[model samples]
Target: MKKLALAALVAVVPFAQAFDDKDEAIAYRQSVFSLVATHFGEMGAMVKGDKAFDAAAFQYRADSLAALSKMPLEGFLYPGADQGDTKAKAAVWENTDEFKKRLAKFQSDAADLAKSAQSGDLGSIKPAFMKAAKNCKACHSDFKNR
Candidate 1:
């Protein structure tokens, strides 16, 4: 009976492993996009609010935002090749060069934001944040599903 149980366990492990891998990939993608949205929202708050500026908080979040863009875009490659939860439009594949250009723009803008945040100047931060936000919005509007 022990041998039979062991055999059964071995048989089920591969399926479980596959499921876990898929789940992890999905979660990672969700995390990336969620962080992007969250940081963007924070920038909006800082710019729109009259509250005192927090340089530390801004720098921390800006650094995170910049680091996120550096991650391999492999998440953009889905297993089934279906759209799934991706808001990425078909044009992303069709107009590959344009998509790449937009992604590069976003990276550049985020890097600039990070540099500006490091300067500890609220006035500089505002414009940098605006530039980053514009790149993000433009990419989403052009390539994202909705």
Candidate 2:
């Protein structure tokens, strides 16, 4: 709760600074998403039955993902952040309001998944996980390059 929020803020603030260089901003967001991907992938494995579902582990990953979901947007705020050695589509900057709406959805979806995972029932967890995963895919399709 408080600790998780504090940790997220601490971890994000330095990297997601008002960037003097666009590359730094790109790197910051990439770093945040890398962590997001790690947690999301582990949770996916459990959700897909590729890994044994450990309730505690699943909950931990979900919490981590929820916290991580809050960090990346700051990195995208700087000027020219979209023009860099990065995979972000120009639409991310050009269509800022829509991109932000998608991100807000992602944050809400991740929070819902975290809430579901906290219940420790695979049956309850699955739908929430799928919803969050779907949000991720949608954002990527619109805003990221292959």
Candidate 3:
């Protein structure tokens, strides 16, 4: 089973390895954001004690989330036309400056969460995570299609 899983991951890695064009870049960024969501959800569960807390796992996920935080905005800056299905609304392109500002704030919050999580203090993690998550909510509320 492990080998099968590894094989599947290997198969998918190539497609995710590079941003080929505007469409591909947008898709790639969206994929990275999905990973960010997954990691953050796992960490949130641990922090709230919905799951057993593992400091190492929380830190790892925090770090992964932080790394992915830096990705999505690059897609917003894609040079050419968009060709993929995106939940991003036209407002993202129209208010490009504001979108960039929002992304920058999210990145800052994500980094802070990562640093706090890395300290291995569960108490600090909750507030930091919440603050960072609000950035996501704000962006989605303004710029994403529902």
Candidate 4:
């Protein structure tokens, strides 16, 4: 069931976008972030030995994160997306160039993680995953409110 749901998400991710409505944009980004957290956490469990490492599953999650990494940025592009029920700080919209740079780094890191996961070797995947994970912390520190 989980695999089926993830497969559905992978299929839909390329078409996902923020709506023109401010509320909808907020919802879109939040939903994307939620999915990102879910997948990232799942990978973390495998990486940290909390969960049995399934190479195939790890690769799938890494690939999903790579796809998801491309989504939230579009949601932030819509006006008023930083307002309303969101944890995104004003700096997301205020420091546009920096925000974009961080997001681009995240996207690149995610892709690298996915590529590393393809080897089905934990040694290869760990550093890539750490790099990708750092982007999350960096972005949250600079752009998201606690």
Candidate 5:
């Protein structure tokens, strides 16, 4: 009887406890990545001449992207955080050492982009954007679906 009661309690405890659900974590990360894409698109439109190059707006958008850059990695910290519409590969959680190095490069690239964005020089911003965008693409290529 005691063993039965303990088993029942263990089963019920999981339901009662507030836990960091992997589904929710994946959803949150997806939302953040969506934001990153939006900002990336905005910058691309300007850089590619699809829209007028508004330096101030570009700076603001670039800065926003840089600030948001630090967020998506946090969402990937949990193991087995797979759910929602995702392109993330298992290596994001499994091969963590390589992922960390890639993440550091991304962060560095974003910082450079942000600094160049403030210069209001299209040439500077262009090179910086190229580097930052490349870093983003490289990570996606390795850890996300094409």
Candidate 6:
């Protein structure tokens, strides 16, 4: 009887009480996003003349960005379930179409950066890196936590 009662309680508990699908997806996306942002920023510094352009470092970061970009788009799909970090505003769901557009822009910019980096030309990389940074900034400014 005790075991039955415990099982019943567990079943009745909200998804958020465990690892809700929505929260899990959000966390996963954020983790990957952080890595993408960090490497992009470092690459930006190198390209912008703030730091010497180190070929090995740039290649490493660019590789990371390219790999991260290839992650399934499903990770970005939020079902409006549990709000874990909840840094994502209600506006995201309300303006679903626009949010998706912004995400596409980010992906496109990252792709451009990846291609430029592969060219092994510092001059080409500098502008492409800057464009990628701008895309990241635009999305974060409008959609992300301050």
For model 2, residues 70-121, the per-residue Cα lDDT tens digits are: 8799889977787869999989988999999998998999999999998899
Model 5 residue 104 distance off true place after TM-score fit, in angstroms: 1.5
Q: What digit string (tens of lDDT, one per residue) describes model 4 on residues 1-146? A: 99999999987867645386989988888999999999999999999999999999999999999999988887888777777999889998889999999989999999999999999999889999998888789889988899
Which ten contiguous residues of candidate 6 have the minimum total lDDT?
Answer: 11-20
Candidates in order, TM-scores: namely 0.75, 0.87, 0.81, 0.87, 0.81, 0.74
Q: What is the lDDT of residue 134 in candidate 2?
A: 93
> What is the Cα-based lDDT of residue 119 in candidate 5?
89
Cα lDDT tens digits for candidate 3, 1-146:
99999999976763333556788877777888889889978987887789998889988998888878877776766665244678888888889899899988988998899899887878878899889888888899999888
TM-score of 2: 0.87
- Model 3: runs farther than 4 Å from truth? 1-18, 80-83
Regions more than 4 Å wrong, model 4: 1-20
Backbone clash count for every predicted candidate, in the order shown: 1, 0, 0, 0, 0, 0
CA lDDT, every prediction?
0.74, 0.91, 0.82, 0.90, 0.81, 0.74
- What is residue 116's positional error in candidate 6, in angstroms? 1.0
lDDT of 6 at 107: 75
Tell me how candidate 6 scores on lDDT. Answer: 0.74
Candidates by TM-score, descending order: 2, 4, 5, 3, 1, 6
Q: Which ten residues in a row have the lowest lDDT in candidate 1?
A: 14-23
Ranking by lDDT: 2, 4, 3, 5, 1, 6
Q: Give candidate 4's error at residue 7 in angstroms.
A: 18
RMSD of each: 10.4, 3.8, 7.4, 5.8, 11.9, 10.9
Comparing 1 with 5 on TM-score, the higher-scoring candidate is: 5
